[model samples]
Target: MSNLIPTGRTDIEWRNESTQKPPKAAVYPAEANADKILKAAYEHTATVWTGDFHNAKQVLAAMKKRVKRPSEKKRAGGGDAVAERSRNIQTAFHAHRMKQAQQSRILNMLAVEIGAGFTLDIPRAPDVKAALADVYGKPNDAPFLLPLNQLLGFIGAHEWHKKGVEIPALGGRIHVPFGVFSPLRGEYLDLIAAALAGSKFQTAFDIGTGSGIIAALLAKHGVPKITATDTNPRAVACACANFCRLDLDNIVIEKTDLFPAGCADLIVCNPPWLPAKPSSAVEAALYDPESRMLEGFLNGAAAHLNDGGEVWLVMSDLAEHLHLREQDFLPQCFQTASLEIAEVLQTRPKHAKAADENDPLAFARGREVTSLYRLKKAV
Candidate 1:
């Protein structure tokens, strides 16, 4: 939603309802009234304000103000709610700009494929740029020509990811990159963590570690040595950063197709089970064309696993529910890879999307079963 509110184009207006027209009070270059405007927003007051991207300093200042509360507890409690409301305001106020930003990203990536330079840099005000610059030790150079959509996405992630995601399963919060693929980190990550709870491996491999979440979990569970790999450079950089931030020096992240050279006592892969083409980099972790990643792990795993070691395959059966893949597809691949399943730990998805009747694949998502299949070399 960072792209939701692009600088300039004062045409953006926020009301309790989307259909509401721009108010006359919303005039560009208007005086900065951060206190009043923020007070009104907190009171659920509807006052449209229009300011060209040039005057975004005034606009963003008003938006960032704390929605004042009377009691100290209420003021301090649920800061997340306040942040959520701010995001809602941003999302609802400039929905069209976000779409435009996304379209720009898609076009940019496609253009880059055919030898186009990334020439688009979303214009940011001094305050906005400074806010982004605040997060350093990672990078603090002048802004480069990042794609409008992706840069905005990064900005949004910088703001929220700074808060970090609490994973009760791991007894910690995982800070992820702006646009990196984050496995919902609950059911799947926790399931795999739980399945390997009592086990202690001298060395472990986390295949396609997007955010290094799984590898970190394995490390926390007493894995002495862990090597993680990812095909995407962004994921590689992201996982590495998260590892440093989380003090998980024990986990080594590398940029590789699936697995690095040599072998380990445990090999873990959480492939995109569905067989389809990914529309974006973000979707790559969800859609595995012809199940290439999945198959790659199954086929290459045995060569890297130590004797009696197992490959942990974490995935969901939503593909079968949607008729995109057969129920026996995974097992068949295992057998084809000359691997035998040692144990199957399954859990039903409890996400809100599963209960949504409007989801096209509600029937499938509702009944989806995620499993961690422990596979070992067949005799």
Candidate 2:
């Protein structure tokens, strides 16, 4: 953790729940240049303290620019390093992930201390009490330290929650809370909307229902009763709120791992598509860590489903393109789970990243297809 001290306070004190002793503090001067700050951050892992909030942001930007800037040798290579790595898609993907992890570690070294009531003592810092409360709930008397990047994320999340994302399929907005996954990509939702159109499904289960988008959509399409479950408390709260906002009274949100207690006519899950470990809570929406969630959903779907019920697994084929999973993996999982694919509905991504040729993974993103895999118990 970064040792962020308030200005004009010389005495240093650290508080924590851990039994281990705190490390010796490394504090940078307020007027330190970005190059000096970057050197300390990258080498000694020093915590930065700035009385001027704007200067801190500028230093962070400069640090990022310097860290990401390619070396002179790479510049002389005629083509960028990413282009060279693109020859092997898997290598490129892993390298990209490594770079991202490295960047996060270095950037997170820039820290700030938030006092009780979520007040920032730094000059030029905007009032973030509301945003802090939204993300961290009620504040305690003790002050806390957080990365400047994460503080920015909380502010952005509050703005997103204030102005919800519009879902064309539901003709309503779904406000996503901090730490909850927002439904920014509409292609997967479109598959659900199309699948549920004019459907007579009575009861449904939305597994891993982040923000309750799937379950809400199910209710909007006339499903009488729906049970949505998520292991994340934040997601459970966010989903419940969204359900109320959409005026969908039939959906019940629960803080369970995946499936709720009884059988249902339909079960839907959009698990994290990547088969990699997530670095943060929010990244859980993208990385599944060895496909645990996916395998769990497939293995348990049959037991919690009624006769003739269908399990709609929404996923993208980007994993295969990146060599993260084999083409036959899903089929084999379904077979092992004694489930058969009734229908596979596919939709190509319409997101900007899919169309951006400059993206390192453009080859994979271009061919990526989001699919609604309609599966059922095999006799």
Candidate 3:
């Protein structure tokens, strides 16, 4: 039980969810020192294997308490320097990301094994077969190592997927699958609904439609025809499942990046807000990595618009506040795309993070404004 069997062929080819190179793991019992585990993880990028479910949780927690964040006062030279650095949004943003990345690296070092048939052999371990199937499909013939933290995330996502997210605008819930972007924040959905209210389009396109919430919203708004597209096969499946649940037969779900073929009178896109690389598959919905998706949508939207049509670009200004993107960037993109901004609908974020003083990015979140840019071909 100490050894993790590979999912395929030889036991040497151990698999992890991230698909990154497997870390060298050493079995650590419940009595293992958390400080020593942290030191090993940091120094050698080693993984800790434990069979005690509760002990793994406790040890991971202990390891977290031992992990040190860079001392802001020491790094900033103390006193007014620390306060000045805190006020500098860009500096604080990068520091926050770095700290988060480091913490994740150390914490993910704690791992657990799943046996064949998706079994958790540890005492007091909850059955995760169903949740594992939800994301990874049927179990492989062999066992694999999974980060305990990521397993917890999978369990939580399973619960959320079971319960589904309540979207008041759709008058129902949207079941977000594991690794798909959940619509925890409803402000953006409200903006979409408000934009479509009392309006009719012959045809519509929902770009990068994760979980098909926006496409469902469009269908609910009485759009006669709609095309929803996503680059992720999981998202495409998620969207298709959601469309079926909503009985939205008119909308077509396609596995394509950004936009589908043909033109539409109305095209709605809620691109990733930040201009940064995503560390994980889920973060793809949050970070755009050099604004590639945003630029693609803007650059390609014009060619996919019918006469007298409008393209609605939904985004947030949080990146601007963080200095990740310049304030004039979108305007410049619009100019280059030869699209005229007809109207800009804006709303302040009401999420808890927006008001949480303890949040590292609170400065940017507090000033964040989500907007729906209604654009048209320049006359």
Q: Which model scores highest in TM-score?
A: 3
Question: In model 1, which residue pairs have backbone atoms overlapping below 3 Å?
Answer: 8-53
lDDT of 2 by residue, 1-379 (tens): 2233432345343322112223234474746766776676666444746579987888788878888856623432444554565579888789778777777766665667778888888889999998888777887477666667778888899999999999998789999978889999998898999989877889999999998899988988899999999998889889988988888889888888888898999999999999987767788999998899999999999999999899999999999999999999999999989999999999999889998766667768978999999999998
lDDT of 3: 0.81
**lDDT for 5 (candidate 2):** 42
Candidate 1 lDDT, tens digit per residue, 36-114? 5544433333232333333444444334333212342352235453444334432322342344333332222110000
Better of 1 and 3 by TM-score: 3
**Native-to-model Cα distance after best TM-score fit, residue 334 in candidate 3, in Å:** 0.5
Which portions of model 3 miss their true places by more than 4 Å? Answer: 1-21, 28-30, 45-48, 68-83
Expressed as tens digits, the lDDT of each residue in 1-379 for candidate 3 is 1234332224532444542445554454445667777776676444545556787788787887677555632453434554565577787888788778777767776677678988888878999998888888878687776778888889999999989999998999999978899998888889888988899798999999988999999999999999999998889989998898889899998888877889999999999999887777888999998899999999999999999999999999999989989889999999999899999889999888888665666556878999989999999
Model 2 — TM-score against the truth?
A: 0.90
lDDT of each: 0.62, 0.81, 0.81
